[model samples]
Target: MYRTILLPTDGNPPARAALDRAIELAQTYDATLRVVSVVNLGDAGILSPETVPVDGVRQSLRGRAEQIVGDAVERAREAGVRAESEVVVGVPHVEILDAAEDADLVVMGTHGRSGLKRALIGSVTERVVRRCDAPVLTVRAEE
Candidate 1:
């Protein structure tokens, strides 16, 4: 019943697992896949020095994000699924939530962290699950 499927990736193994699942669902439902990779500029801001030009760092992250989404879009197209992708600069969960607004469903991967570790590290998937309006299907990373 899904018309549009949202898939967010960071080029990680967990995200790769989710990409596979999202592609499968898109194929089954004849849905258009929307793949996105967000560059968390805040993290870079904290690590970068005043001497380092922000534009250089942003361009680097943007390039990487573009590659991640481009690869995902290529995979989906190779499987004969209609797909589009974008690279955004923002907080991961916030950007994902914004993208999810137009999606019929959101498919993503979770690290499955729990308790103290989870609390300390936080989770983008968890935040998206909590805030997104559309239905979210989470694929856990294999340990």
Candidate 2:
């Protein structure tokens, strides 16, 4: 029932399973895969002082994000699915929700943090789940 599936990866262990699932779903439905990684440039910026750690950290984070998306696209392509990827800089939940506007579904993973811990730290996946324009399928990561 999906035409384009948006998979947001953080290059984390939890995200690997979700990426695999997204690729499988795309293949099964003959749909396209769109992978994205957000750099979260809220505090880390390229314009920071040249010698400040933020500059290097931002560069490193962007490189990692690009690699994650590129790898995901390659994996999807190898699976015979039409796939594309993007690297965005913004709040993870915001970028993901915005991207979802053009997607049919969002497939992502959750770290399974709950209760006090979950309350203490809000979840991007949870935000996307609550505010996404399209349907979202959240897979729980293994402990």
Candidate 3:
């Protein structure tokens, strides 16, 4: 049984699909939903002088995160689910794992990218699944 469900979104198509599933599950179980969007801090150590400034990058990321989570929260509300949203700036996987402490379950979407692409970009869902103490439900993006 789930009382509080955490759904992390990035405004990606896959994430939207996962949000729908999370909402359906929340409704079925009479649970509250908490949507979170993490703004990743890009590589600070290796940035060249010609690269975009770190502060500018962070601001852009934060703005996008806010927009994504706000939209997801509105959708959840429209579905008659009690929903709250938060935007955090940090490592995605670490923030998600920390959030799981207060949540009964974490529902996330997987892009299903593999090999070098997956290794370079990494998989937040996989990291969350491996590290979070709470139950994680991963929904792969539909083809």
Candidate 4:
């Protein structure tokens, strides 16, 4: 039933697993896949660094996001799924939710971190699941 699927990747192992799942779903449904990677400027409340030239960091992050999305596109192509990619700079959860507005579904990876680790880092999937209007599929990373 999905026409356009949005897969957000962080280039992490968990995200790779999610990409695999998204590709499989896209292939089965003959859907167009939009792979997005959001480059977070900083953690929580802290800004990266004013002295370090924010533009340079943003450029670097975008480059990395491009590479990540490019790799996913290649994989999707091999699977015969139509794929497109975009890189955005912002909080991961916010960007993911925004991108989902035009998508039929949003697929994302959950690290499943809990306790102190989860409390300290927070989960993008959690936020996206709460905010997104489209159907969200969350794949948890294997231990």
Q: In TM-score terms, which candidate is top? A: 1
Candidate 1 vs candidate 2: which has greater TM-score?
Answer: 1
Please, what's the RMSD in Å of model 3?
A: 2.0
TM of each candidate vs. truth: 0.95, 0.91, 0.90, 0.91
lDDT of 4 by residue, 1-143 (tens): 99999999988988999999999999999999999998886832237555667677677777888999999999999999999999987888888888999999998988888899988988989888888899899898788
Q: lDDT of each model, Cα atoms only?
A: 0.93, 0.90, 0.88, 0.89
Query: How would you encode candidate 2's per-residue C-alpha lDDT over 1-143 as one tens digit per residue?
Result: 99999999997877888999999999999999999999997657656766778867888888989999999899999999999999988899999999999999999989989999999988999999999989999987677
**CA RMSD per model (angstroms):** 1.2, 2.2, 2.0, 2.1
Candidate 1 stretches with Cα past 4 Å from truth are: none
Best first by lDDT, ranked: 1, 2, 4, 3
Q: Pick the candidate with the highest lDDT.
A: 1
- lDDT tens digits, residue span 26-85, model 3: 999999999999887553322546665777767777888899999998998999999999
Please give, for residues 1-143, the per-residue lDDT of candidate 1 as tens digits: 99999999999888999999999999999999999999996855647779978887888889988999999999999999999999988889999999999999999998889999999999999999999999999997788
Off by over 4 Å in 3: 43-51
- Pairs in steric clash, model 1: none
Candidate 2 global TM-score: 0.91
